[model samples]
Target: MTRTLLLFATILTSTQAQQGFGPLDPTPPAAPIPQILTHMAQQESAFANARDHYTFRQDVTFETLAPDTNQPDGAYHQLTDISFDDAGRRQEHVVFAPANTLQRVTLTEADLDDVAHRLPFILTTPELPDYTLTYLGRQRVDQLDTYVFDCTPREILKDHRSLQVEDHRYFQGRIWLSQQDHQIVLIHGQAVPQDTRPGHENLSPPFTTYYQQIDGKYWFPIYTRADGTLHFPAHADALSQTVHVRTTVRYTDYKRFHATVTLHYGTEVPTTPNPPQP
Candidate 1:
């Protein structure tokens, strides 16, 4: 009878083990998120090959809508001609309205030296972070398996500023990155508040950016669309002294290496004054 009892106890213990009710834990360690971001950064950093000088042409369209306006009211169309050197330094950014009509032309040479330092604000800088990556989750964009992540602010001041009682100024939206190359194929998120007002303090706009591979190395945005509300003081109402203004910007029709040009990069560039004609 004692032997029979021992056998029954052993059988019960085995049954529990088989049913996953044993003493051992089952959860596995999660993959490090920073490591994934680092991997993405490494891939993007080596994308573009170093060249002596390269130029790209871009078309820009900007529109702003007033309060309660069904359509965009303020519209502007312009073209940008940018040149970069082998060291990935911007030499010139000639902005024209149409037919080479010079609206604003920047020469890295003397007399216009100050503006050259600010080129990174407009053109891509070699050392800049490829993207702000936050692990979103596994999702599909365009029927392809992708990992969703949030692009955080790579700039310090831009990231620390809060939007409202509980909001982050930078990286408040979500992005979908392709699992294959870890490239940001689609981005959907809200824009950081541009102004501080009573009801408008925490306002955020919806922004989307789409990336496509260019020259097989670089992944640049082929298309982008963003719309957001800008708040303004209500003229007549004091208690409710703010109205939402809609604004949008879109980019299309990209052309690469339109012209062969020479680039000179340094703090000082040789200036060539207009040669006096006889």
Candidate 2:
């Protein structure tokens, strides 16, 4: 009996050595690119659908000119408030400076959607004109694997064509999105005038938005900055008139209710209705 037991113990030791003393793990490798993209799109869609849309308050600060030199020692302030329904309809109000007087114009849903969709670098695609979106690999932001999308616009969007132009024609910028949450960590775009001269130039606006996830399915912009410059003509009469205008907006003091974070801009939305309400 003793001899048999010793033989069994030796056999067990040999088997353990051969098997590396552990059970084999058959887990597969990570999913491929297509799978990842599909997962992201699904998450985005779900988040979009489940989001609570509300009106946002906006404060705009424009660097003002000194009537003589147009230098920006002072700034003009404007305020706007906008809310959107689930159907994507928007109601916006605007307020003017100094007295915080309310403006008469109210924005419709179509107008709101137009502004949101047309906002540069907000929605990036391969089709925007002169604009290119390149995947610049990935990095970790806020403990999430983020894919970076870089962009550049084709030209300054001054004409009405810019309104109708596809996303392919818009300004170029960089967008960093979290893979796991599909949250936008940052989005920035800059547009520059191509036809303008070197010294006397019109610089396109730079837009930057920083987003944070509130609900599991939704992300909101916590901060937004829009900056641009206008160049006056160098000839006589225009030389003395130099105006550098800058409009900046900050989305802060967020109050999260359900899936929506009620936002307040620097200013109030103008409240003008079509055809002038008597």
Candidate 3:
């Protein structure tokens, strides 16, 4: 009897380690899952619209590390100010951009686009139908009580053209939403639909984005980081290689652009104050 009990305890510990979480609470949420999903989607839609009216600076860094030393052997760095033009057209002004030195992996346009948009993912009401969201129960994120959910795309569309490497990309990950505000506070996942074609391989690493309450109401992504190893299989001309890469993106200096734009969320129009300029 003693031996059997000890073996069961060992198995339970191993299972927890692999799953990354203990058993979820059997108690259901206060509201139905469908209702919760709709509310969260609406809040996210409002946040996305409000973010566009804010001007901020983004600093991005990507590095390929040496296996032995775990230090950067090659790197890419860029700093840009994101704001709207007089015509309210979104614009990005590069403050500083250095030559890329990465040798193993080349950064594609899609990768940079992901850094700008997908890293700070948003699932709006219209986008809700394109994804499948499953509630994973309640979890505490620092001091805030949050509801956890797994989000994945319903389909990955592929272009049939031989030259096209990728057509559509989607965020495949988990999100933590603040229970009080129904706003996303954190996202952990990666861009999916990575092309594994022999000669044209495109892969993305998993990443995490942490949001901070900006202007006292909206949760805005402030920092994001990704670390992973990408493997490229051998093709007709080249041999296989594995590259260890790390990326970090920081969004700061947020100030609401005083425009005529109006963003509404659940009948509430929260006032936003302009941040002090440096």
lDDT of 3 at 60: 96
Q: Could you give the candidate ranking by lDDT, starting with the highest?
A: 3, 2, 1
Best by lDDT: 3
lDDT of each residue in 1-278, candidate 2, tens digit only: 99999999999876665532133222321445445444545655554444335445666554544445756666556576655565656555675456422121122243223234433123312233345445566654444556765655544424533443223234456777676654456777653322244334433346676677665456666566665554445664345334444545654444433454467799897777689567
- The RMSD (Cα, Å) of candidate 2 is 17.1
Q: Give one digit per residue, the lDDT tens place, for model 3 in 89-140.
A: 7699999999989887899988998997789788889888878888888875
Clashes of 2: 39
Whole-model alpha-carbon lDDT for candidate 1: 0.46
Residues forming the 10-long window of minimal summed lDDT in candidate 3: 156-165
Which 10-residue window of candidate 1 scores lowest in summed lDDT? Answer: 114-123
- What's model 3's TM-score? 0.80
Greater lDDT among 2 and 3 belongs to: 3
Best by TM-score: 3
lDDT at 111, model 2? 23
| Whole-model lDDT per candidate | 0.46, 0.50, 0.84
Whole-structure CA lDDT of model 2: 0.50
TM for every model, in the order presented, reads 0.53, 0.53, 0.80
